[model samples]
Target chain A: MSKNDKKQQVETTGHEWDGIQEFNNPLPRWWVWVFYVTIGWGLWYTVAYPAWPLLTGATEGYKGFSTRGQVAADIAAVEAQNAPNNAALAASDLATLQTANPALYSYAVNAGGAVFRTNCVQCHGNEGMGATGYPTLSDDDWLWGGSVVDIAYTVSNGVRNESSPDARFSQMPAFGDILSNEEIANVVAYVRALSGQEADATAAAAGQQVFLDNCSACHGEDGKGDRMVGAPNLADALWLYGGDAATITQTVKNARFGVMPAWSEAFRDGGLTQAEVNAVAIYVHQLGGGE
Target chain B: MSQGDTPLYAAREPIFPKRVSGRFRNLKWGIMLFTLGIYYLTPWIRWDRGPEMPDQAVLVDLAGRRFFFFWIEIWPHEFYFVAGLLIMAGLGLFLFTSALGRVWCGYACPQTVWTDLFILVERWIEGDRNARLRLHRAKWSLNKLRLRLTKWVVWLLIGLATGGAWVFYFTDAPSLAVALVNGTAHPVAYTTMAILTASTFFFGGIAREQVCIYACPWPRIQAAMMDEDTITIGYRGWRGEPRGKASDPNAGDCIDCMACVNVCPMGIDIRDGQQMECITCGLCIDACDDIMTKMGRERGLVDYLALKDETREREGMKKTPIWRHVLRPRTIFYTALWSAFGLAMVFALFVRADIDITVAPVRNPTFVTMSDGSIRNTYDIRIRNKNGEAHKFVFSQTSTERLWLSVEGSEARVVEVPADQMLQVRVYITADAGSPAATAERTVLRFWVQDLESSERASADSYFTGKVR
Candidate 1:
């Protein structure tokens, strides 16, 4: 058949655009059936799933499915699977946990890493590499101690905090009130010399007598620091609050007081569980600084 | 012409194609066997890849994130190889379509092959075209029900086998087959097989020509790929027109026997000139040639002919040679593009390293100050061992002589990576306080890992941050 003959047989929609008329060719029956099937499926889907929004909340359909509920269930399931391990880790002795049960120790370290990410990253950083004021957990320059037991105690009671009675407590009397500005400057030079930084030799010699009288009790006579009092070692170059002349002068005048929160739930509300405290201790200990 | 007469939808017209035998039909049969054989049997072929890797020569180990084909293994990071192959397949289709017309659609398409097999089964059970048509039009009866049930069961079985073969490509064939019989295979495997089976049966047995004409996009795209020199199956309207009986005085070669239409799987008339519905299967040419020979007429009443050749023949001029038509610039360009991708992929596969390393510097606290006033930067280095046996790799730095490398848990800068697995280790690079690298804001660090046994080294460059003061 010719094109004209076929065109004449088919009806036109009577809508013309730029002199081209639209043909009213029927769609395939299968396509129309599929369209109807989709409509039916959509109607069923609304009834079976949470679809409509109301004033209070979305309408809970027959399935009662919510993404929040799904995530909660997933977390609960994982927690249930690790319940035994968590219980064992919480009860194990921090000193001998690693050698007694290496598998459980390993599990605690991984689990503690997750807890540390959520609760400790703000101060300790993501990799436990601390900032200027904060002490790096991955290094051997811990002000308190690097042993797993010491870490656990610090994490449980915290440092110089009013919340826990057993918190690691230390107080440095601010010397700005008692000592003159010249004395503070001379002591700063002496402190810098102890850490092997450039210092005024005459001032450092004079400040040595002042340091023995004022700072030797907590910082030790040799300036090696005392772990019992959580005093930082002045013999090493690792500084928590900078080793510069200006910063050292400020520290000698007013002293530094860093407060950490007690992580054990026994001491504070919303604190980490016993198992979490144990895990984080193991994780921090394994960061290459554990004794 | 009336609005009321024009319905909004039209039903599909069922086609019962008559069976025909010729060189083209035989060629289709041979291609079907060859392609199907390769599909169903490839997964079962075994190659000894040692104890650490899979033995299947052709397998898509989705769980392991690897693609194994014979001697070559592809990791997930090398998915560009798969992309290159798909590009080559597309170019090959273009090359064939430009030279010959819908050759893939006619002879080698999975749809065509499966549908042909389904038709062969239908012919064997229903006694060919006329009998099948009569049976289709006849009212429901016990005999009709029996024949219909038998044909559906056979079609379903063929579909099952096709689906079964497909799943074997993803896993170990023998174990999966045993698990399937034991009803213990993964639910996903069962679900995938069921979906593929249903689709194969529906498209091959029932949908048939509708899939190529309405569902597939290739036929529409082929229109742009073909030009006047493209040889396509066509009826010689110049010679075959004015069709009449042999007894007529002024009759043409065609006897109006409708033999070509009867043999068409697409249910299209080749005598209507070129149409989109025709697959150019050459079956019509085969059928018409048989009829022309019996009538003592010259052959090629329906044959593969280019539009340009038709114009030449009508003008009483010599036709262009087949080589000239196939070797034109368009076909040559497509062939060259297709070959280039194939060669590039092969070269990449051969030159790929057995050990791969990637270093990601920890940037949270850019640099850490150690007790000794040294600046340390941490990196998470992932080493992928593609070898069949475990190998120890010694880590070292090629740049920044002041930088010292240390592994996290080891006393020495050495790590053991398991065979065919990727292991991540924490690496610390330290620069002494007096060194220039320790004071620079950023230093380019090139870390190298060498296999202790083979000494094959792979290096990755990363930035090392240090204290600015």
Candidate 2:
């Protein structure tokens, strides 16, 4: 509107569209210079880096930078950071490390947790709480010893832990071989009473002598059996073969010893170290009920 | 007249783009060769990813829910990487559009390149533009019959190759190739090939320029992005109008050659001014330049220029060339946006992780109480192993009373996860019956997993329900 404003160099083309006019203004000064700079830079970049596709390959740029090299450097940095912890795990005894160093024990536990999910979680639960037949580690009761060392040994050798005749050797013999049918019936009644199952008083009393003579050798007179022999304590009320009349009768007659595969073979085959297993034991103990 | 004033009822004419040759044509051919070569060959390339990972160089294993690209293995949880890649591609398009108009559509678009290739085969068998036009006009001949049959055969072959190469990206390429050759590929593979073949033939061989003009949204969007300064393939009307025969005393520089129209792939006369169908491939410029040399006139009768310059020159005003208009505000804004997005994507990749966890609250009876006076909640936790090696995860929780985690079946707190597998199990968390809120209160708990050797820990949060005391 002003004379000075009208003197401004910019001009709009005379031709007009609906309501719009084309400003015949020159591009911004900064924009033009930057465009030139980038064009120059692009030329340099093409020379210095891989830009053009060749018949057989690509032209190697002068700078020699590569995504592969960058990735390799990152992996190396991570590896360097992990070196010390890896060494510590390789050197220490699992049980001692767990009891002596909480940090190291925790690391092992964490490691073992990962290992468990990978190898053992399919059969065992994710947290090592056993399914129907699988034993739960979060309880005070343990079939094998609950001590870290005891657990390590059990994991290393396994239950029925032997490779031969004496492997962790423990079994309850069949009372049916020596006792009469009536006597076996009475013993079954007495065993039920030990587990607080109902039994006729007369039947249990009649079986007492037969139990004392035949069963009391491994099972104490009180029916608190030796754990060393794996003869479970009857009074404690945890039944391995089950406290039912039929199962008890069958167990007493045939005797029962379940095979627990040796953990050493599994350990070696699974590619787990002894210390790693110890860490898992300590982690299992921390699950709440270890003595 | 302004574009809006043009008659709306004007019938649209079908275009059969005639083929051309020269710099841009050769450039398009080179791009097609390289892109199709990579597409067909990449799946067969091998990578040494040790023993646990897939060896295909580029593969999307859907059943495994993983993607393998050379040394990089992507787990399903890390799908953000793929999203980031798509963002980068979009940004790349913006950058290219700001700098060079429709370069992507002209040289790199899959549709344009393939259609051009198919058209080349058609021309090779049926002859050039004029000959084909003349043949269509003439009565049926044995020569014409043979040419048409040959063209169809070639078009089908190209379609089959394009479709056959696509399935290789989804599975082990070499093994799948053997299966295909032996007639034992999966039925799904056969179905995919059939579908792709039909689409390629219909789109690239038949539809051609109709896709660029009507079927695509890009041309409309690109029109919005352009400003007065934007360079499009244009005709210099000042040098072309006041039309007369070439030999007339008043004849303008154009010389009525029509060479530009003959060479256009979209078959539009650049001299008629910019149209929606121009791909900006610059073939018309090459053709018109060649014509100008013969007529002994100044070149660029049809050229790349802005609407403002074209109008001003026609009105006899001195024109400011391309360099003067290169630094506009729109160009600067687009450049800055593209750079910022690219940098953000790089930063995100650095912080992104390869590990993830999801917790599911038990559906049936969410909370349970034990005989020993403890309140318990059950959850089915699914832990995914994203790395290449198997790992163990230890579970722990924090609550009012010391919260104990028991895996329903296993005896160990350590859950071992196989590489690239999801481990699911029911976990029971119990707090002593003496807790402050014994009946029902939400308690926030944390589950942490530490890699035994690396001591790296990952944690997730979930709530446990208990009876209020």
Candidate 3:
């Protein structure tokens, strides 16, 4: 507390807080050395890498690094790396593509997924579950076979359309003009009974003869419906339309014929290329049900 | 000595640690040689891990995302083994530090070893302590410049080797060396070498003990890790206090020869008492012991002594055994933890799966209604084959009687996953009219993949998304 006990004042920055004076001390030797080293490093970095800005353009340092150039190089490298896989995919048969090279198969599946989202999702639902009257693409039940090549063919030519000359064109006769309403009802009941739907036994018995005579040409015996003609099997539990008495009667009266657009480049509406058609076919075929 | 004229930030007082012949010095020499030998030669050793994998005994394949060590190969997912090893190393340092104070820094640390090597080269070219100090005070001459240039060139060569050895661990050593000579190696390799070389030369040659005193945080943190029982080199103040000339018979055992001060690498006087800068290499003890023997006095004026034992000796009690200092609670704890971590990592390595299967159900539309009226669900199946040999697996599913499963592109129910690759295949599963899951909106489907040769099976469960019929 005595004035004599007070230490001699050192050089200060002329500032004091709570009686504590700030001393004008020099930096430590190691700290100064470290600062000098960083300054040297900064000078070297400016000389060796893209750094300072000028009036017209920035100075390209010795390395001449650029973000755009790096990106272009990276993209080029990736494309070069994938060129072999693309070639393999182009050469392989559509049916064997999945098993031949898994790398290319994955690439096709991924690329096909994108094409399916853009072109095929409208009628087939988002995941190809299919709305009413539209065939479910994800299922194993294929009216024209679920083989990859078969799907590819169907995708290329389409069905029941005048657009493609090679299209699968088969139509059921609308017996409404030839037969009476009673005969149409009987046939409907028989078809419903074949698929194990509730139906009138007497009516089904009488309708069997009419079906054998009129529909057996395309639907075949036992009503299995021949794949050669793309006729759906009536004996199975599946139906394109409702299987009720009224719905089937309407179907037989009108003769349901759903039309799919040909994805081949030969068709209109900006049809896909052969590669794209193959991609979408592979996509739809592999959605859990491609045979 | 006037306070007003003294510099707050003093210039570095250069150190020239005199040569000493003692057991600790010999131990240091052996450790340095062994460590440097292993570091420089490890990348050159080769081990055949079959034709599919790299042959280098120790390699860090950064591009391939694999680490190869002798017979063991580590994938990216197995990085926990590396983490465990790092934890064990940390605990090992703790264990050693609790028993022997700063022994890692004293002998085995890269900083200490490299600095010692640099100093050895400096003494070889310029001469020993007195001669080097004299040369420093003298004016610049052709002889001095020649000696200095030779020393720097040798130092630079050592730095180059150190940097070169580091980069070799990440690549095939011989091929990389050839590429380096041909200027065909990756620029990153050369840049890394330049950075490392510069740092090694600067820290080992110029910075030296300054790093331990100023830059490194270990000395500050380790003070809390030590206790009174930990062994550290210290001057026996009781025996050597009031340090008087040897002619005075009343003086303590210490002759005040200043031998310990002349030989200290840290430029500290041991007689000043215990300080943070001591690495505990025990060279001062050897120098002082030589002086003691020449004067016909008892040795250990400056020696590896525990603070507690020193206090006890001052109180006229018998010094306890060295084992008592080493065998204590913290050291035992650290040792036990380090061992436990090592054991756990080993156990994990043995039980790791060689085959893994994962299934992801397509959830966009979930299920589609087939023409045959069967409910179908799509699942993406990924099978990973971790083995070196190629293998085929039987693909099957567990479900009700009406459910049938098949891999994409084939109805054979067999799939092949190549060696060290993942095969992603879309699997279509159809559930017939009477299946139980057909009526449920969603259900867990178990898909199995069994190796044809080993019968080792792996299964994955995914929700089979469907609609109620």
DockQ, each predicted model: 0.36, 0.02, 0.37
User: Model 2: residues >4 Å from true position, as ranges?
Assistant: A1-291, B1-19, B244-246, B315-326, B398-400, B433-440
Ranking by lDDT: 1, 3, 2
What's model 1's overall lDDT? 0.90
* Best-matching candidate per DockQ: 3
Candidate 3 residue-wise lDDT, B19-122, digit = tens:
77777778888998999999999999999866676789999999978898886778777898899888998888888887899989999999999998998899
Clashes of each: 0, 39, 1
| Least well predicted 10-residue stretch by lDDT in candidate 3 chain A | A1-10
Predicted candidate 1 versus true structure: per-residue lDDT over B1-469, tens digit per residue? 4444678666877778888889999999999999999999999999988898889999999999999989888899999999999999999999999999999999999999999999999999988889999999999999999999999999999999999999999999999999999999999889999999999999999899999988899999999999999999877888887899888879777899999999999998899999999998899998999998888889999999999999998888887998989999999899899999999999999999999899999887677788888888889899999998889999998665578888876778898888888988889899998688888888998989999999999999998888996
Q: Is the docking of candidate 2 incorrect, acceptable, medium or high quality?
A: incorrect
* lDDT leader: 1
Select the stronger candidate by DockQ from 2 and 3: 3
Greater lDDT among 1 and 3 belongs to 1
User: lDDT (0-100) at residue B213 of candidate 2?
Assistant: 78
Number of the predicted model whose TM-score against the real structure is largest:
1
Residue-level lDDT for B73 in candidate 1:
87
Say what the interface RMSD of candidate 1 is: 5.2
